[model samples]
Target: MTVYRPPARKRLTQDERRAVYERCNGHCAYCGFELETMHQLHVDHVIPMEFYELYEVEGYDLDSMDNFLPACCSCNIYKHTYRLEKFRAAIERMPDVLQRDAATFRHAVRFGMVEIKQHPVVFYFEATGVDVPSLHWDAEIEKKYRTGEQK
Candidate 1:
């Protein structure tokens, strides 16, 4: 979706992804990929506070750096939103969605747990006008987090 920044969600003091790596020992909580060895890494919001209807980060803002993390491309795409309740309902009967390697209050994304389809995530790119796909999210995310690049 189109991420609308109201000047507040626009910036942060320190590097978010680097911080997450330090916080989580360079391991993606979702995919458990070690950033130390990974070619590219992504810093994603554990809870998507930036609401969206079709495009843009809208509605109530919860732009906290603590919500960010170092995640693999797969996990970040799957755990895109904070509406875990809806996910629970959507993937209900599939006990796999309920299973987590570790407990997370708002975000418990385990990468490679399920074969997350690309269609749903492709909607976000279309809405946001971003060209990055699941295959390239890692590189794209790293660029954004490290050097503040957006395309």
Candidate 2:
């Protein structure tokens, strides 16, 4: 099978990147981790650009900033080319996936070393009531994330 390589992504300038960063108040949109440095942050595409090539969708600008969501390095890497919903579903299934594939995780759970919190996968952006489709970020909105508020 021939692999289709998507075109290069447009690079955002510092100001543009700052805007994206501020979208989640310097937090990962998926995991809600406070991003410390620019190098550690990733602007993930809410709808992967690969979808445009896969489905041959025309007139849809997948590269537009409207599809951008600030993410930490891990979240961006894990999310990969999955669309938002698929990514969410994958996150929801991670415990099952880990329990099946990772002996360490399974052992930890079995021995009461790890406690799995079963709940729907809610992205940070979703929890913050951010308008994801429009890519709107309300900087004024306060976030009570697990890691605690930003100092």
Candidate 3:
């Protein structure tokens, strides 16, 4: 797996950051903790930024609204440059991590941050050799979101 490094660029303006927080209901997308009570909140890329550089020849807009999510400091640090599948696997192996991240893990699945496939129903992160049960999503729903036809 590649480590995603965000490009050096202007940071999101206060208004833009505020919009993301509001969109996520002022809670950490992964943990659902109220942002107001937390010492800090981080704006995260749902898809690792490194993925864009590695796969997209046209370049990806890392600052796009659809790619951003609100996360608490711990969640942000814990997630680091992991792809969603890897992050989910890590959460599952550790009881405390799972307890703190279950809601967010389910949210990622439902929202299509993590890909789902049937077959043997296993998810594997090649870099880390972590495997876990597959999460499911409605393909049509995910397509709608990906195409900007639905929020």
Per-residue CA lDDT of model 3 for 13-106, tens digit only, reads: 8888887676556777776667894337698776666655532333345446656777888778988888666876776666445436788866
Q: Backbone collision count in every prediction?
A: 3, 0, 0
* lDDT of model 2, residue 53: 64
Ranking by lDDT, best first?
2, 3, 1
Encode model 1's per-residue lDDT on 5-36: one tens digit a residue: 43444454446546655555666654456667
lDDT of 3: 0.60
Candidate 3 has its poorest 10 consecutive residues by lDDT at 129-138
Model 1: residues with Cα > 4 Å off, grouped in runs: 1-14, 37-39, 51-61, 82-151
lDDT of each: 0.47, 0.78, 0.60
Residue 49 error for model 1, in Å? Answer: 2.9
- Per-residue lDDT, model 2, residue 146, is 42
Give each model a TM-score. 0.41, 0.78, 0.55
lDDT of 1 at 107: 44
What lDDT does candidate 1 reach at residue 20?
57
Task: Count backbone overlaps in model 2.
Answer: 0
